[model samples]
Target: MGRKAKYSYEFKLRCVKQVLNHHQTVEAVSELNGCHHTTLHDWIRFYEKYGKKALLPRKNKVYSLPFKIKVLEAIEEDSLSFSQACLKFNIPTKSVIMNWQKTYKKSGIKGLNNKSRGKPKSMQFKRAKKKSSKPLTREEELLLENESLRAELDLLKKLQALIQEEQSKKRKP
Candidate 1:
């Protein structure tokens, strides 16, 4: 699933129309609509390249590793800009290509593999706490006793500080 679009299709269409049909400057239309000029320019570009359908919200897509490599190769071989590559590949955003390029550069083909989304597989199967059949050894018992003593000491120190703070406040008054 993809995040909901901040701008509605109709709103984008209206902005694009204002620029293309009304012949208004991108900056003027964008400023009037309380959006960035570059954003408006992108809308215009998508509209010109892919028609009205491009303005609609797209579902999250998982590109295969081969397809990812192909897109990267095309960009490098054809010397395509991010925007041009996006338009050619029908990618919704340029950031997708940029991220793919970064991943490819850092880790090669293995990095391009689509990682499983959401909670990891390890988290799904929780390890249940096993009850020990035998009693704790003498050293183990000492360690547990020491931990309890440390906790008790910390609690007493906190209580002492609170009592001191209270006494100081009363003395101040």
Candidate 2:
């Protein structure tokens, strides 16, 4: 397995202090900490230059759909290509352009707007699954009753046919 990433804020400060204040060489601190000399040098530079922002973890920067649409509009207005847009906006990828173009072509403005774009959480489905569902309409109940009566009548006709067949056989014998 790869070695875990080491990120000790206090340790970074100590290393930076040793390099800056004690006249310790980056190579010496690197050797003592089991890190690369270049890595130690970079840390020292980062501490000296950016202070704390260089050490703090960066949050994921997400652009909303509307924001993305605006970006695309700006790219179109500037007549910039995908690569140019990526460079101009400092975006990490080209898929952003492709996706925005697709949405713009499909929906004009509304497609780019934020909306719940999938099957809604089914309140109707939940109601249907309840132990006591809403009562059927009178027409629906009447139709069901008619169907049951029809089935009972058909069963009675079959019993009558069987009885007639048995009687006819007895008469023949």
Candidate 3:
């Protein structure tokens, strides 16, 4: 639901060119273009490293865990850099390969699995909230009774305080 910032490849190219060809300061160029200097810096880096092709837009691709593992293995075996992998695989961006590398390291093959996005609508199916109508176990009953006693004790404390205040007022009078 949040607004996503989208920039055309041409705009990025122009920004990169301005920095590269015109000798314009990255900070000044980015400020004039209404984009951050770091964004411009990244664009320049990508342009310099991978050329304009790196800035081109591509459709989203969902990679399977097997494919992810394979790519990770290739990267490890070949000692390929993230940029090299992106170049060799024709990946839209280097970040995809970097993310895969991170996932591979953190969770091996399992991390590549696509997790379900967004909050669940219902808690009934959730593992934690599985209350039943069955009679409570002894320990559970004791805990329940202890909670009940604590609530009563709290109420008694408030009443005791009120009684003590009343007695104190009468004694003062």
Which candidate number would show the highest TM-score if scored against the true structure? Answer: 1
Q: Provide the clash count, candidate 1.
A: 0
**Candidate 3 at 150: error in angstroms?**
35
Compared with the true structure, what per-residue lDDT tens digits does model 3 show for residues 7-81?
888999999999999999999999999998876877787677778887876556677777777777879999997
Q: What TM-score does candidate 1 get on C-alpha atoms?
A: 0.69
lDDT string for model 2 (1-173, tens) is 33344756677777778889999988898789787776566666565666755544334345787678777888889888776676456553468678778988998877776665457876754344344487888998898799999999999999999999999999997
Model 3: residues >4 Å from true position, as ranges? Answer: 1-3, 16-60, 123-173
lDDT tens digits, residue span 89-173, model 1: 8898889999999999999999999998887656567697586999999998999899999999999999999999999999998
For candidate 3, the TM-score is: 0.46
Instruction: Flag clash pairs in model 3.
Output: none
| Total colliding residue pairs, candidate 3 | 0
- Pairs with steric clashes in candidate 2: none
Most accurate candidate by lDDT: 1
Which stretches in model 2 have alpha-carbon errors above 4 Å? Answer: 1-62, 115-173
What is residue 114's positional error in candidate 3, in angstroms?
Answer: 1.8
Compared with the true structure, all predictions reach lDDT values of 0.92, 0.72, 0.81
